[model samples]
Target: MTTAIDSLLQILDLETLEHNLFRGRSPQVGWQRVFGGQVIGQALVAASRTVVEDRQVHSLHGYFMRPGDPSVPIIYEVDRIRDGGSFTTRRVVAVQHGQAIFSMSASFKVPEEGFDHQIGMPEVPMPEDLPSEKEMAARMPDTVPENIRKYWERERPIELRPVDLTHYFSSKALPPKQYVWVRASSALPDDPRIHQCVLAYASDMTLLDTSMFPHGKSVFLPEIQAASLDHAMWFHRPFRADEWLLYAEDSPSAYGALGMNRGLLYNRDGVLVASTAQEGLIRRKKPRE
Candidate 1:
């Protein structure tokens, strides 16, 4: 039941080579040198190793400098920017082919009291009521594509129920916003770190595609080449990733081969738990003669 994407998520384990240098490996998932989310997740895990348990990551910002090569391993060099009593920050540079392919800045903060407020979760069909992405793909197997079918077959760590699957694959132009209910496939442990990491891994799945909704382009479209360029995430409060959460994403702009999208994650109780923004390449191919 596990898909290639699910297996990719599990390969982010980091091995320490020195005080600041870490070693990481990624299996090739076809033509994509490497999935953007994999580097983000691995970089996060490498950063987490340097911080204390009392501190939790509240924000992470990353930029993709170039495509990664899955044929080789990536070396992460973490720079300890600042380690304060209440806050710690790390800069991670992921290197391959003797060059930096990805870089990220992460900030961790100890628990602190602050004003709390969040928008309510929208009312949407439950997972049981809606069909799984795989089921929907089965209806139009062509939409799933052969190159990416392995990704669809992989085990998903997060459950995603598209509010309107038909509108998603159809050529009809539609609104730029999308709503999906997501949560960890299995009940997570008590540790909040695990939940945060799991959420980080799941956040990259379908967010960038929101930008293409108005253009009526499926992410699997063979003619279009999609790649994430940058990613940013902010944690608003402690929340469980295993519980039902609403992910509402919208594309604010797309131009010059780039697409920008933002997302708001709300817990089942209607509390906004996190916010995320990402920009990526959405280059379309010229029609062949």
Candidate 2:
């Protein structure tokens, strides 16, 4: 595995503090707050550890209660809610500084035959047809904003290639829809739970940003405040995180200083593997007197 993927695996590997409790740490990336996806993935890992290997996660719902302190370790406490014949439920709370920073409930089920149906994947350029993250950074024009250039040039565990680049440089209001091809920077182990956790980490990457597309705003803007409030995901089929997947995202509404966005993740062969929904705080900052 590449260093990036290894680092990600390390981040997901939680230490057992006690019965039903796990401790996780963040990478020292100089961020003021921990990444929401990291919390979600780690919380899921904690919940999964308590579940039987025959049961796999099918759905998860999480809420970000407070900004996580990246400088310190997070403690996750899991509750074994229920264990039925075919379904298991777990609730996890991630605590930092003596308070809950995030909470999540995950449900798992044993594999069973079921009717299958999914919406067709949208037609878009494949990952190979788009500019690589490194190439995109290298081709950035001088007029491009520094903050955006920094984001493009940063090395991350997941590589994203947007189908369109207009929104990156322009503030023009556009449709609240976007498509990005994403995948882990390196191969991962053959564990399905690991793949699911990694995908959960990547799910939060760009979903909330789609909410700002119609307003021609971004979380990076100094005058705009954006943070995820709640996140939900449903795993539909098995998939590998190291393979390219299309993240088709759109915002359905933005009102009352909040935005709601949803996404469908499809593999290269057009099979829908997962779906996500999120609501985020998106308030514009007032000018100082």
Candidate 3:
């Protein structure tokens, strides 16, 4: 694995503090608050550790209660709600500074053969045909904003190749839709749970940004205030994070200073492996007095 992926795996590996409790920390990446996806993925890891091996996570719902303190360690407390013959439920709360910052509920189920069907993946150019992150950065060194350029240049665990790059540097109002090819930067362990957690981490990367496409704004913009409020995901099938997957996302509505977006994850073979929905705060900043 690459150093970035190794660091990501290490962060996901929570420390066992006691029964039903684990400790997780954030990378000192110069962010004011912890990334919502990191909390979600770590909380899932905490919940999965309490579940049986046969029971795999099928769905999860989470809410951001408060901004997480990135400089401190988060304490995850898992509650084993119920364990049935086919399904298991676990609740997790992430705490920092002795207060709850995020909470999540996850459902796990045993594998059972059933009728399978999924929406066909949209026709788009393959990741191989798209410009790599470094290439894009080098091509438009002056056009890309400083913050966005820094993000793209960073050695992230997941690599993203967007089908359309116009939204990054342009402010033209367009349809609220986006497609990006995503995959782990390096090979990961064969554990399905790890892949799921990694997918959960990557899912939060750009879903909320789709809502801003119609307004020609982005979370990276300093004048726009954005933060994820709630997030939900459903794992429909097993998939490898190291393999490329298409994240098809669109925003259905944006009102009351909030934007609602949904996404579907399809593997290379056009199999829909997961679905995600999220609502976030997307209010514009007021002029200074």
Minimum summed lDDT over a 10-residue window in model 1 is located at 3-12
Query: Number of clashes in model 1?
Result: 5
- What lDDT tens digits, residue by residue, belong to model 2 across residues 81-159? 9999999999999999999999999999999998989999999999999998678778985756788888888889998
Off by over 4 Å in 2: none
In order, candidate lDDTs are 0.83, 0.95, 0.95
State the lDDT of candidate 3 residue by residue for 64-164, as single tens digits. 99999989999999999999999999999999989999999999999999998889999999999998888889989999997888888888999999999
What's model 3's lDDT at 175?
99
- The ten-residue window of minimal lDDT in model 3 covers 1-10
Listed per model in order, the count of residue pairs whose N, CA or C atoms clash below 3 Å is 5, 0, 0
Q: Candidate 2, residue 24: CA error in Å?
A: 0.2
Model 1, 1-289: lDDT tens digits are 7654355446656788999899989775454587787788888988988899999999999999999888888999999999998999999999999999999999999998888777777787766787776776677677755645555455556678778775554677878889888877777668787778778878998898888888888777888888899999999988998887889899999999899999999886678999999998999988989
Between prediction 1 and prediction 3, which has the larger lDDT? 3
Question: Model 2: which residue pairs collide?
Answer: none
Using TM-score as the measure, name the better of candidate 1 and candidate 3: 3
Off by over 4 Å in 1: 1-10, 28-31, 140-151, 287-289
Runs of candidate 3 with Cα error greater than 4 angstroms are: none
- Determine the backbone clash count of candidate 3: 0
Q: lDDT (0-100) at residue 124 of candidate 3?
A: 91
Using all chains and alpha carbons, the TM-scores for the candidates as numbered come to 0.90, 0.98, 0.98
